[model samples]
Target chain A: MTALTLHAPILLVALPLLGAFATPLVGKLGKGARNTLIGLIVLAVAGLAAMLAIDVFGSGGIPTVYELGGGTFTFPLSGGQVPVRILFEVDGMSAFMGLITALIALTGAFFSFSYWKERSGGNLYFSLFLMLIAGVFGMVLTGDMFNFFVFLEITSIAAASMVGFRVWLKQSQEAGFKVMAMYTLSGLFVLLAIGLLYGQYGHLNIAVLARSIQGSLTDMVALGLLLTGLAMKAGAVPMHMWAPDAYGESPAPMSAVLVVNSQASLYGLFRILFTLFGASISTGTVGWILIVLALLTIFVGVTMALIQSDLKRLVAFGAVSQIGYMLLGVGVGMAVIATRPEYGLVAMQGGIFHMINDAACVGLLFFASGVVIRAAGTRDLNQMGGLGHRMKWTSIFFAIGAVALAGVPPFNGFASKFLIYEAAFKLNPFLAVLAVLSSIMLLAVFVKAFQAAFLGPRSNTSAHVSDPSLGMMLPMAALVLVVIVFGLFPGFFVDHIVTPAAKALWLGRDAYINAVLGG
Target chain B: MNIGNLPFIVAALLVVLGLYTFLFKRNLIKLVIGITLIETGVNLFLVTLGYRTGGISPIYTFAPEAQQMVLPTPQALTLTSIVIGLATTALLLSFAVFVHRHYGTLDVRKVKELKG
Candidate 1:
């Protein structure tokens, strides 16, 4: 293997962390220098993610296990059977998640170039942004439970700080506090679950724990805590109260990154359910619970979004509803894991595929919203109008994002949602019907937002509004390109990356354990 | 109840009490305190996981020849948890300060600017 492939996993996480700490110092140089530094850091992280993804997917989904404090692939410590050192086990699923994070981080960094131009504390802002990226990479890459908790905290602190970055705004402060409180509580729930598992298993390694778990009372309790905590973090309904506040209050670019962060949490939840406790637990029951949560999340998120006056908050609700589709698609897979139904894998592929689709479409929407807010100087939809007159590119991009997010045909969202609808219909026609109904509602919601924001006669407030600079427009354009490409060739992506990722969760449990434990 | 289970019971009680405070408390500072209480409870639970009836320190140097030693990993984990808890508490308190400054009250009900 090339040296890049050999150390890609750790470098993917470490470079951003090192760059985060170095950002303020780099900023001391000048704006040009600071931007250069951040750009290089993000580019390097993205390159590493690509290398890692290629390696994992190219190897027929064989996971690359990197052992810290030891050589690569070291297993069964010298004196003990359990691996004591930290390990980064990057399978197809992890590589896929890493790719999503890298894409979003790169675009966010690009968008922030102009977004934070006039804002003060640009240095600290980028620093926290990079830190959040690092935390997410670590969360997705690590193989140890304790290490996951640490990265979880890292993401929590950085994300909460970023959400509250606009200290001048009282609403930002309120949102930050509420988000921090919820994040910490959920984090503690994860930590407590880890503690319970450790108390019984005497090992923090997920593979080791997975091998030995027997679904005891304590294991069940740990499972409960983990499910609740991760579900809350993933913005599932009833536990997703903090999402709109955090997403709406944060700077626009950070909103996109925040979406990826929640997906990382969702990644964690899937990892736990599929890999760690797959054989030990009654997955069907848990799957039903998730399905219920998914249905509620879908219905409530769209309904709540419909009434929002604020543009970002409305998109935030849309983002929350999107999470339900992912849960529903994967929850169906989990429900039929034992039966190994042919459609189950298709359902999983749809869910896993939707993650990237959502990232692109929602991210494009947020980026476009950022431009609109900056140009119009307000987030209220009621105050925004006729933006399309001056900002043609942004209007087109916003329309694309809205249509794609609503799962219209010939777009990335429809490609994945189609799979979900097909698979879910076979499982239960009611689920498919509800999902379709929600998609229609989502279309109406975004149409209202689009018409109110961009389609009418030029309001006095938007008289000065115009398309953003190249730095901002490029990211949205890139996302738009992704939406089109992925839409046109969903089968290509699903066949190559998405299927392997879905299979990694569906049938790669033994392979994951063996990769780490060397059975 | 067995004497051996007392620490676990106390830890659970502390966690329950902290949850009660977190759910019922109105003041922002009190909410921070509630989170801290929960962290302390979790930390205590982590430490107790390694406890033995009559164990020595986990250190190897100058250790007694025959006596048992408590597991050191849990202690290490607890210390790390404590440090992380400290960082989160500081951040939460800073946000609380900001909230108080802007809203002029720590009562959560009064901090309603972010509601749906």
Candidate 2:
């Protein structure tokens, strides 16, 4: 491998982190310059991440593990299973998540120039935005459990500030506070779990610790804590009370990245489940717990969305429910892996694939809602009507996002949800039925929203409404392309990306251990 | 089962109590205190786990009297957690101050604006 490819793993994280700190300095140049700089930084990171992903996906599915600050001289004395320095392990799953995160951050940054240009705290906004993005990359890329905890805290702090950015608004501040409490409390639980593992195993490296864990009572309790904490962070019910508000309160660009933030927690959940404990976990019982929670998250998330009149709040609830499909798919896979490995693999692929697909679909929806909120200068669906007459391009964008989010045919959501249904059907008929039903309800929910916001007589006060600037339209169009392309080529995506991602988690234990141990 | 485990049990209860207050308390200040409590408890748990009876500090001193040293990694971890805990508490308390300034109340229920 060339040095650039060899170094892409660390560059993927450090570049954004350095850019985060550099943003305030850059902001002094000009708002336009600052936005352009942040966008370029994200684009660079995305390019590096994509390169790393292509190399990994093309390298016979072998993961690229980079040890930070470790040359032969620095750690030549190290001979144990646990590597002492911080490490970035980019398997198919991590690479995939990183790629999507950079993509969302890129679009979010692209859309931010227009949204945040005249707004206050432009410097603080870009700095915090970059920090949030960097935190996600750190969270997804790290190999040490303690490093994960630190990055989790980093992300939550940035997220809390971003959520409450509009402190003049009572709801925004309150949402920030509520999310802070939940995220901090949840974060403590993660730290406690990390401590428990460290106290027992005397190592922080995940692969090393996983190899040594014996599934004792302490391990069981640690797993329980990790599951609850990460699940809560992922917005799984009944701990999902913070999600809708956090999403609803944040500005549009932040909300787009926030989608991926929650997905990072979900990625952590899956990583811990199938990688750290896959070799020794009692899959049936643990998987059952996840499944039950998944069911609750889905049903309640959709029902809640159906009742919401606030445009952003409605989309937020819908985002929560989409997380359930991912959980259910993977949870089902986990439940049956001990018996039917083949079906489990298929289900796992569907679940992992849905992460990226959900990022695209929900991301598009959130961005479009931001556009509508901008043109109309209000977020209430009741205050909106006949936007199509004024904002033709944005209405079309919303229509595309709406149908794709509802899992209609020729959209990305359908392909993954279809795989989820078919694979989950082989495991249990009711789960599949429930998946289909919730999807239908999702369709109904968005259809009602579209009708409320776009299809009626144009509001007399909304002579001001017009199509969004090129900033917003371009991102939505980009997502529309993603949805259409991925939808049409589901088989190819499954074969190339999703399967490797599933295997990285499903069959990662031994290879991960051997790599960390330098065997 | 032994005297050594007493601090561990107390630490666990302290965590539970902290979470209870953080989740159930009406006052925002109490919620902040709750996080501090959990941080203290977790730090105690880490320190306790790392302690070795009749052992000295793990510092790199050349004192002839030193024989055995306690495990230092958990101590380092706890210190890092404590620092992070301090930063979060500062940020959260600042957020609470802003909320109170804007809404004219410190009660969480009173500040509920963006409801689902």
Candidate 3:
């Protein structure tokens, strides 16, 4: 491999880190120039990440390991044997997230041009945006547990700052603080878990630790902390109270990207479960607990969304519910993997596919809602009415996103949700029933949102609103295309992308362990 | 009752105390302090993990006279955690200062303009 190709994983992270710090200097070029630079930077990163992803996915879909700071040795122990080292391990799943993050982040940056054009602290906005991207990439790709924690902190800190971007708004600051508190506590819990593992094995590298994990009481305790903390980050119910606050309070574009951030935590959970603890832990019990959490998350998010009148809050709840489909699919997969391997693989495929679909559909919805808020200057559904007449394209985008998210036919949501519902039924018929009913509730919830926010006669407050500018409409249009393409060709994605990703999680454990250990 | 477990027990207690204060406290400042305490506790546990019965300094460059060395990895982990703890603590504190500047109070209950 060429040096550039050999270093794709590190470049994926470092390029963004460089851009994050360097953007302030670039921002001196003025708003229009600054925005163009930021857009170009994100777009470039997206292309590079997509290239790396396709390369890895093309190469027989195996785990690709990159030892960080240029070395192949795992760790230099006192006996001259290597136990562990800092590394970036990229597989189908990591590539999947990197691609999704890049896509959504690029969209978020493009949309921000129109969304935050006149806002102050635009320099800080670009810096944090890049840093958030870098942090998330690091989190998903890192091979070591401690590096994951460090990256998690970076992502949360950047996300909290972005959430508090509207510092003039009191609730924005509150949301920022709330997110920060949750992130800090979660980081510590994760760190403590890492400590337990390290104390037992003297290695923090996931592959080494996974090889050595005994699943003892200490392991169970560490697993408990990891599960709880990662679940909280994923916004699973019971501790999901913080999700709406943070997701709803952020600007629309930031909210779009935040969807992927939530998914990254779920990704971490899956990685540790299937790779780190796989074959070591009792998969049956872990899967059942996840299933329980998934059901609660699905029900609670839908029920909560039903009562929300604020447009952003409604979609935030919808986002939370979408996470259930993913967890339900993967949870069922894990639950049954030890018994029925085929069903488990299919379940995981469904969940993994759902992650990308959820990111796109939710991102489109958030951007559309942002468009409505921007044009009509309100997020309250009660106050927003009949913008469909003036904002034609925006309304169309919103309708497409709403239908797609609700699992209507010919939409990507239906495709993945179908896989999940079918696989879940194989596990147990009741899960399928609940999954179907919950999705129907999601449809009802968004239909209400559509009726309240986009349907009625134009209210007095929105009388002057019209179609948003091209800069805003373009991103929405791009998402509309994504929704359509994915919907139309779900089978293609399922075979090429989704199945390989699930395989990487379920079947690639040994390959992953060997990549670091064998070297 | 053995003294070997004392540091670990103390670390666990610190963590529990921090979680209690973090979850139950009303004041934002107190909540931030709680997070710092938990981080410190975690750092302590990490350092404790590296402790060997008769270990000397892990620095091999000087070739210390003592042979049995405590694990150096946890100490490295602890140092990284401490650095990260500093960052999170600083970020949270700044946010707290911003909260006070915005709302004129440190009470979290009073800061709920975003609640459902």
By TM-score, the best candidate is 1
Q: Where does model 3 exceed 4 Å of error?
A: A72-83, B1-3
Model 1, stretches more than 4 Å misplaced? A72-80, B1-3
Residues A177-204 of candidate 3: C-alpha lDDT, one tens digit per residue: 8998998888899999999998888888
- For model 2, what is the error of residue B44's alpha carbon versus the real structure, in angstroms, after optimal superposition? 1.5
Q: Chain B, TM-score, each prediction?
A: 0.95, 0.91, 0.92
Query: Number of clashes in every candidate structure?
Result: 0, 0, 1
Which 10 consecutive positions of candidate 2 chain A have the poorest summed lDDT?
A72-81
Task: State TM-scores per candidate.
Answer: 0.98, 0.97, 0.96
Model 1: pairs clashing at backbone N, Cα or C within 3 Å: none
Ranking by lDDT: 1, 3, 2
The residue-by-residue lDDT of candidate 2 on A1-519, one tens digit each, is 677887887787778888888888988887767777888898898888888888888986666778888765322124663577777777888888987897798878877777776789888888888888888998888888988998898899999889987778777877888898889888888888988998898888888887788898998899999999999999999999999989998987788788899999999989898878776789998888888999899999999999999999999999999899899989988998888888888888888888899888888888888888877778888888888788888777777777877789888888888888988899889888888898899999999888888888767856778887787778888888888899899899889888888888887666666666655
lDDT of 2 at A20: 82
Tell me which of candidates 1 and 2 scores higher on DockQ.
1
Please give the RMSD of candidate 1 to the true structure: 1.5
lDDT of 1: 0.92
Compute fnat per model: 0.74, 0.64, 0.82
Clashes of 3: 1
